[model samples]
Target: MTAHVQQLHRVNNLCAGLEWVADCPNRLARKALLQLIGEEVGFVLEGVICASEQKIPGGRPPA
Candidate 1:
């Protein structure tokens, strides 16, 4: 699989893990984990966006 697909899968797994951690008894740790997950997902999305933006309108990406 491509790196983009792998990153998406990783983000999906992180989301699922976040859902499981939502029930944790420790509020601080839970919040920290959630924040980390959010940041990770954000970084992945940013990368995707940057990659897309790198493509030009000539039916090909810049060299």
Candidate 2:
């Protein structure tokens, strides 16, 4: 649980950094940073979606 919390904290920090970079004046740098942020956010969201899809196995098997 500690590790999970730490991971979420790191992701939050990442987003904060990405927000700061959004105003970068260098066009190429801005483009690269935005692309990286997009990929990382997508990866994190994919994991979250997969975790939420897990079943609790409450129902009995169908006959």
Show how many residue pairs clash in every candidate, following the order shown.
0, 0
Model 2 vs truth, CA RMSD: 5.4
Shift in Å, residue 59, candidate 2: 12
Return the top candidate by lDDT.
Answer: 1
Lowest lDDT 10-residue stretch of candidate 1: 54-63
Please state the error at residue 51 of candidate 1 in Å: 0.9
Best model per TM-score = 1
- Candidate 2 lDDT, tens digit per residue, 1-63? 454456567678779988688889998999999889878877776555454444336533332
lDDT tens digits by residue: candidate 1, 1-63: 287778888888988998788998999999998898899999997776566657645444533
